[model samples]
Target: MDVAASPTSGPATPAGPDSAWMLREAEQFIELFYGEGNGQGGPAARMAEIRAEVAGTGTYTHTVDELAFGARVAWRNSNRCIGRLYWRSLWVRDRRDISDAAGIGTESVKHLVEAGGGGRIRPTITVFAPDRPDAPGPHIHNEQLIRYAGYPQPDGTVLGDPRNVGVTELALRRGWRGAGTRFDVLPLVIETARDGIELFELPPEAVLEVELSHPRYPWFAGLGLRWHAVPVISAMNLEIGGIRYPAAPFNGWYMGTEIGARNLGDTDRYDLLPVVAAKMALDTSSNATLWRDRALVELNVAVLHSFDRAGVKITDHHTESNRFITHLEREEEAGRTCPTDWSWIVPPVSGSATLVFHRYYDDADLRPNYLRRECPVEGGPDRT
Candidate 1:
């Protein structure tokens, strides 16, 4: 059974027998992950070895190549993710041997730095230790490696990202003293079944952030808008076949809406819509005048322009939407059905303006998918 990691404490394990389903999943993953070029021996020999390992008392360790391929395929099978077109490009780091909290924190910085790519953000994933036959795997309590803190002010308004207010409160209760700033990066929380939990402060070099600015409007830089360069999702379960790896973290270059539309413009987030709109001298009298929409477009323009000027890797919704169609066509040629969630695939700001908005997509979980797990928090599963 999968373990639930809480923000307040360590993870809890629910014991379950190793069943035939796990073996079947392992077999499926081995076949799919290895493909034609398996190992030095052969695919048949490798499959036999995997089967023996699964059937035996000791746990099986995936070959280096298997780990890499499995991670890439997991990205490919993520139906809710609109960025699967570049799934094959994922760089996977196999850290299955690491179980200590300190090791995870140290290596996670490497994960961040490598994924940062010195401004050219890369799509990457790191596979940590898997849940063993007797115990649960170590878990990352933070939703992401880098996230802005939310400080609840006396006026009942959050001083930072409002969406993270609850988690920030939990962190404070757990002895995390934030800088009380709008963009304070949260500390790394690692919860283990054996050692309980520990905390690690992120080093300065591990985080690559960009200051937001407009190309023409100099005042936009004065708004003090900025965002982290990479989004390292740290809480998803990487399911290859039937095996679940709870501590695996992955990342990708951010889409423009992820910054401009939702993170900054959302009402509960930074809520910069009214602020940006007023600065642009747009009519704030009513919603019918499209002032909010116009402001949103300009905000997105600043995001794209800033990232571009900084030499970071980012894709616009229109370009990515067209690429999704291209991905579908390629999948069709390969006789594979492409599973997509329309609500997420469409751009948050300009849903009707994008091509992905007008299409119907089949919802399917083919294989080797990354699954969203229910966190210990009460408000359902947390997104990383």
Candidate 2:
């Protein structure tokens, strides 16, 4: 159920009335994704054209990366008939090579322009590039800054003193605690290689991490952000070719799962924890309408497995698996329904899985900070 998939299999052909309707819808999806063919033939014809283009050259390159982000983030800006306000951050880097493009581009990028009327636009994004050291090679060492601006035009033009746009001068600002934390905010990073995008590498001991959230789920406290907790539950050490690759933390601001209902509530600070480290927990607080009511939940539990002691190089790899279990009981409460209990075994490179519970908390308007609410039968925090 991964929402992002290459829509290129089977008879997605537009035939018959029903098939034609589906074909039209599918083509529209393709148009939004490629950002071409604004001139209609419906969506089907455009998709067929794109399919043919890739088949001809065996390369499917896009300026905006993926179709979803371009549609949701980029297209809306250009399709003004929607009458919605739009914003985007144009990031730059010092250098890039095409061969190392792994997870570059996203489904959340957009192109926007506003003219006439007293208009206010904010272009807030994180820009990262290799830090200069005499000469710059692909060391992967770079500097990033969170940029915010009040107004602007489409072809990367700006109005008034951009500083007056209210952007904090410090490149690395933290939020509430680190609202001003000074890291980059781009969703995914990419570089150009031979003819396509590739993943860049960090030069030896120089590691960098940043927290990025969906603009719609800004503050980080509410459940909107909590959904990312799934990665914590999904993390499993992988040993490939005698090398042990540690599970990379879930690094995005919004919850990164492909299953279940989409969380539509405003996010508070407590909900945004998964983007930083790899693990976090939530307090249902016995609210049936809130946590209990959702059709599904993504839990981030640490998995113990065996693999090579060395790490595996991550390329354009996205591994996914699903499990279905019925009965779960809350440990703290003798009578309450508990969460599901499942485990993933390690390969030879690693051994035994451990379940580490890291709870998510809200510290924004704290007269008294909220702690993890305990289950009925057991006490909180330090439960055995």
Best by lDDT: 1
Estimate every model's Cα lDDT from 0 to 1. Answer: 0.75, 0.21
Model 2 lDDT-worst window of ten: 301-310
What's the CA error at residue 81 for candidate 1, in Å?
A: 1.9
> Which regions of candidate 1 deviate over 4 angstroms?
1-17, 34-44, 378-384
lDDT of 1 by residue, 1-384 (tens): 001110111122223535566666677776765563555755667767767887785456677877777777766656666677777788888899898899999999999999899987888788888887877788886777787778888888988877676667767778989887899887877888888867788988999988899997899999988888888878677766566688887888877887888889888778898998889999889889999899999999999999888898877878877877888788788777777777667778788988889989887766676666666532223322
Mind sharing the TM-score for model 1? 0.91
Summed over model 1, clashes come to 0
Tens digit of per-residue lDDT, candidate 2, span 1-384: 111110111121121223334334434445544453344455465566656644464322322333223322321221111111121231211112212323222111211111000112222221112112122111111111111112333774333213212222221122211122212121122323232322232221122222223222233323322111111100111111111111111111111222122221112112222332222233444555344223122222110000011121111111211111111111123332222112111111111221111222111211001112212111111100
Candidate 2's displacement at residue 251, Å, is 5.9
